[model samples]
Target: MCAYAGNQRLAGVRPRRPGPPPPLDPDAPIPDDPGPLLPDDPDDLPPAPHEPSPYTEPAPETPETEPEPV
Candidate 1:
């Protein structure tokens, strides 16, 4: 009896199954999908910082603190 290569790896493989083979998953990152993929409403999206994020911008003024003399 000859051992066929197809027999070694086909467990749970159904015979006479009609349709295209399962699609392969792509390992590469998609160019169109630059990530930080947002959820529809996971609420996990980080809240925007209330203040300006950049240090180059002047610090926001606050009423509680007096401005120090330079």
Candidate 2:
């Protein structure tokens, strides 16, 4: 006999049945009003500070006219 011949077949295996559904809550009916997730007033947010632009021109370079003796 093969080494795995005595093992149980998995073809008929299935997950166990789940328990009874949770009890329903009658008070969870749809709310009349849904409020915003964040504050409605502009004052509630912090002001963003200004940042320097990366596209600005760089400073001019000074020319070196003299060559050192070898």
Candidate 3:
């Protein structure tokens, strides 16, 4: 108990070590830095859907093109 917090800081009933940090709201609204991840920003948002990476090699089956006119 650290001697009852040093007798409550010599009877001053002390308990406040946090005062001096509230003056930076100059229209505070500028927090958006996320445009540089995939292929160096090629529309950075198509590479985070896991659960199918057996050494990654299973996306090649497109051979059915035969749609006649109406």
Q: Please report, in order, the local distance difference test score of every candidate based on alpha carbons.
A: 0.61, 0.63, 0.65
Error of 1 at 31 (Å): 10
- As a whole number from 0 to 100, the lDDT of residue 14 in candidate 2 is 57
Better of 2 and 3 by lDDT: 3
**How many Å off is the CA of 52 in candidate 1?**
12
Instruction: Please report the candidate that would top lDDT against the real structure.
Output: 3
Task: State residue 1's C-alpha deviation in candidate 2, in Å.
Answer: 25
Model 2 TM-score, 2 decimals:
0.26
Clashing pairs in 1: none
Q: What is the lDDT of residue 50 in candidate 2?
A: 61
The lDDT-based order of candidates, best leading, equals 3, 2, 1
How many clashes show up per model? 0, 0, 0
Give per-residue CA lDDT, model 2, range 1-70, as digits (tens): 3333356545655547999999989888886777777788966755444643455654458765788889
On the 0 to 100 scale, the lDDT of residue 12 in model 2 is: 52
- Provide TM-scores for the models: 0.19, 0.26, 0.25
Tens-place lDDT per residue, model 1, 13-65, is 54465889888779866568565678777555555677444435565686567
Once superposed on the true structure, which residue ranges of model 3 sit more than 4 Å away at CA? 1-10, 25-32, 36-51, 56-70
